[model samples]
Target: MFKSILAAFDGSEGSEAALSKAAELAILCGAELTVLTMYRHHSVLEGSMYVTNADQPDDVDAIMSNHAKATAERGAALARQAGCEKIRAFVKGGPTARTIVGFAKEHDNDLIVMGSRGLGSIEGYLLGSVSHKVTSLAQCPVLLV
Candidate 1:
């Protein structure tokens, strides 16, 4: 039984499913549920290509961080709707898999639940999925939903 559970969410369909499962398990185990969403810090060149708002040209990282925070809150809302009482949501900017694993370790989570796939780019297909990397890196148990 888990005392604390970490759920990796990206606002993708796959992640939604994983969040639901994580919520169910947290409720069953009377564990605390922590929802995490990660965003990558974009370089100036990369940000310029993706920036749409001329007003906030150099705030790409802030924009992405805000979006990630909203995504994490949305996941936490869904978990609460599923009857989970003890829940917290967080957003971080870093390499997704490594960040998740580090957060889980830092928080001493007993288990990590995440989707097999997420809102990853073509790089994920070429390198590997976040879930795959997290499973390999995490010290605790990882459950891919």
Candidate 2:
């Protein structure tokens, strides 16, 4: 039985499915659950690009960071509604696959449950899905939904 379960959620349909499954498993096993949302770490150049937008706020990075936090909170709420009592949510900015795997290891998670596909860009298809990379890189068991 899983003791610590981590779910990678990106607010996509696939991620929703994965989150649901993770919640169910956590409730069944009486395990701790964590919902993780990964956002892009904007570079100086990328941050500068947002400065020209008339409607965008002064601190674009802060806005994006807050959005990531909100997404993670939503995922956690969904898990709680699904009957998972022990659940936490986190948001980080980095390479998605690497971040997920690293968090799982750092948190000593027993299992990783994530979507087969997330709200990835076209580059994901060109390179690989985050789930694919996490599965290859994680030391613990990975379950893709």
Candidate 3:
């Protein structure tokens, strides 16, 4: 039984499956759901420009931050539609796997539900999926949806 669940999403097709599964599990367990997304914290272009002018605005970072916020809003809407009353969302930067793992840890999540790549066995092994990395490293139980 899960009291708190964490679902990692990127507004991508793959994450759609994960969101649905997390919602189902949350509903069955009567658990609160938290959706998580990761975005790069800094803009490569702006960072590079800092060498010449450190006072200029960071256009790239602002652009990416807006995108991340939009993704979180969309995710929250989807979670609400899934009949989850205690749905929330958080955004972080850095590696996807690390972000998910850290968010789960920080939030005291009881379970993590993520999407499987559904690739062929060979492909899965050759190109590891984010779900695989997260499940393997997370401290709590993980459910692949």
Candidate 4:
């Protein structure tokens, strides 16, 4: 029985499945459900490289952070619809896998739930999937959907 459950969500199909499962588990266990969405921080150099119009210069990191916040809200809404009463959502900017593991540990979550795959970039293929890294790094149990 988990006291607190952490669900890593990114507004993807796989994350939706994971969120549903996490919500179900949280309801059954009477645990607080926390939905987290992560966005990688963009360096100034990288931000500069993005195609931006002279009229409206886009801040890449701000855009990503906003999107992440929205995604977390969506996940929390989905969990509420699935009957999870104690639900919270958060958005973070960092390395995804490490940040998820760190957040779970910091919050003392008993279990971590996430999609087997997510909206990963080319670096994921070159390095490894976030789920795989989180499974390796997490101190608590991880459930991949």
Per-prediction TM-score to the true structure, in the order listed: 0.93, 0.91, 0.79, 0.92
Per-residue lDDT of model 2, residues 5-78, tens digit only = 99999999989999999999999999999999988877777887774456656666677888899999999999
Tens-digit lDDT track of model 3 for 36-110: 877766657656654433554456566556677788778878988888778988877777777788889888998
TM-score of 3: 0.79
lDDT of each: 0.92, 0.90, 0.77, 0.93
Could you give the candidate ranking by TM-score, starting with the highest?
1, 4, 2, 3
Residue 91's C-alpha lDDT in candidate 1? 94
Q: Could you list the CA RMSD of all candidates, in the order they appear?
A: 1.9, 2.1, 5.1, 2.3
- Stretches of candidate 4 off by over 4 Å are 52-57, 122-128
- Evaluated at residue 99, the lDDT of candidate 2 is 94
**Where is the poorest 10-residue window by lDDT in model 1?**
120-129
lDDT of 1 by residue, 1-145 (tens): 8999999999998899999999999999999999999999999888878836766546789989988988989999999999999999999999888999999999999999998888887666643479889999999999988
lDDT of 4 by residue, 1-118 (tens): 8999999999989899999999999999999999999999999999988986565539988888888998999999999999999999999999899999999999999999998888
- Any residue pairs clashing in model 3, and if so which? none
- Candidate 4, run of 10 with poorest lDDT: 119-128
How many clashing residue pairs, candidate 4?
0
Q: Which of 2 and 4 is ahead in TM-score?
A: 4
